[model samples]
Target: MAQVLPPLLDYEQSYPCPVCRQGQLDRLILMDAFSCNVCHHIFSVNLSQQSICLADRTPALGWRWARQRWRPLHHPDIDFPLGIWILCGGLTVLPPTILWVMHYIFPPLPDSSANSFPLLWIGVVGITHSLIALWILAEFYQLPLYLSWKFRLQS
Candidate 1:
C-alpha cells in the first residue's frame, strides 16, 4: 500500500528556517507545526499578543543552530566578525599614543604639575576607551545570540 503524503508548501508559503537560516520552512499542517527542509528540525509555534516564539519554552533537544553551527541552547557560542578586534585595537592604541606624546613635549615638573595633569585625566581616558570597546563587542555579539535563541524551538 502507498502511504499518503500531505501537501507540500510553495516557495512563497515557506519561510526561512529558524534553525539553519539556510533552509526553507514548510508547514507540517496536520500537526500544527513547521519543519525545516535543510536541517530537518521541527518547531512548535507559539503565538501570543505579547510575544511569539518557536518552541515556546525549553527545547527538547536543548540545542540551537546558528551561524552555521550547533551548540548548547543556553550557552551557544556567538560568532562575530574579525573586524571588531581590529577596530578595537586601533582605538585602544591611538588615545594612549596621543596622551604620551603630549606629556613628552611638556614635561610636567615633579612637584608642581599634579594640578595641571590631574589623575582624573587617566580615569577619563580609561573609562572612555573601555566604553567604546565594550559597546563594539556587545553590538558585534548580539546578532548571533538573537539567532540562537530564535531557532531554539523543537516540536
Candidate 2:
C-alpha cells in the first residue's frame, strides 16, 4: 500500500532559532543561548520571559579563576572505573585462590565431576566479574559529562 507523506516544511518554520527573530534554527548550542551563524551573534533567549538578548563579551578570566580555586577543594565524585577495577581484580583473584585451596584439601570424588568444577567455576566468575566491571566503567564514564553539564547550569 502506498503511504502519503506530509509536505516538507521550511527549516525556519519547523525549527525557529530561539535566539534570533529571523534566523533559521541551526542547532541548540547551550541552554538559553544559541549561535546565529548568519549574523555571527550569540543570542540569549529567556524562556520564562520570551525575550532574546545578544550575548555580551564578558571577561572569562574570573570564571576560570573561580573554577581553578573551587575545583581543587571540591572532591570530584568517585571514579567508577577505578572502583570496578579494584572490585573485579579482587573478585577474579580471591575466589579462585580459595576454591583452589578447598579443592586441594578436599579432593573431589574420583567418580564425581569434581575435576571440571574449578575450571567452570573460574570461567563463570571471570565472565561475571568482567561484565560487571564493564557495566561500572560505562556508567562511570558518563559521570564527568553529566557533572560538567550540571556545573555549567548551576553557574
Candidate 3:
C-alpha cells in the first residue's frame, strides 16, 4: 500500500535513521543538514521534494518520512525490509512443511479417524503459525493505528 508521508517540512523535527533504523536523524547544530545519532551519517534535505539523501553519498538515493518511519523516495518497488519478510515467511511456512513431510514419510495410524487427525492437526497448526507470523510482520512494520495507540497508551 502507498503511504502518505509527512513532508521533511522543517529541520526542527527528528526522523528515524534510514541507515541504522534505530537512531533519530536530528538536525545538526549550525548546519542545514541532519545527522543520524546511531549511524553518524549526514543527510542533505531537499525541502521541495521532502526527501533526504546521504550527504557523502549519491543524491539519487533518498528517503521521505512516514509518520513513524522512513520510506525510500526512489526505487519504490524495492523499498521493503527483505530480512524481516524472509524471516516471517520462514516462520509461517517451515513448521507445517516439516510436519507434512514427516507425515508423508511415516503415515498416521491406519484407523479411519486417525488418518484424518494428522491432516486436521497440520492445517490448524499451519493456520495458527501463519496468523502469528502476520502479527509479527504487522508489529515490525509499525502499522500506523496500532503504533500510535501503543505509544499513546504508554505515554
C-alpha lDDT score of every prediction, in listed order: 0.57, 0.47, 0.77
The residue ranges of model 1 lying beyond 4 angstroms of the native Cα positions read 1-80, 113-119, 143-155
TM-score of 3: 0.46
**TM-score for each candidate, following the candidate numbering:** 0.39, 0.37, 0.46
User: What lDDT does candidate 1 reach at residue 62?
Assistant: 40
Cα lDDT, model 1, residue 53: 33
Better of 1 and 2 by TM-score: 1
In the range 1-155, model 2's lDDT, one tens digit per residue, is: 94332233211222333222234434354454545543445544444432344555443111111211111112333223566678767866777677777778887778985778876886787677677765565454435554456446766
Which residue pairs show collisions in model 1?
none
What is the alpha-carbon lDDT for the whole of candidate 1? 0.57
RMSD of 1: 12.7
- Per-residue error for 126 in candidate 2, Å, reads 1.9
lDDT tens digits, residue span 21-48, model 1:
5676666767656678856777654322
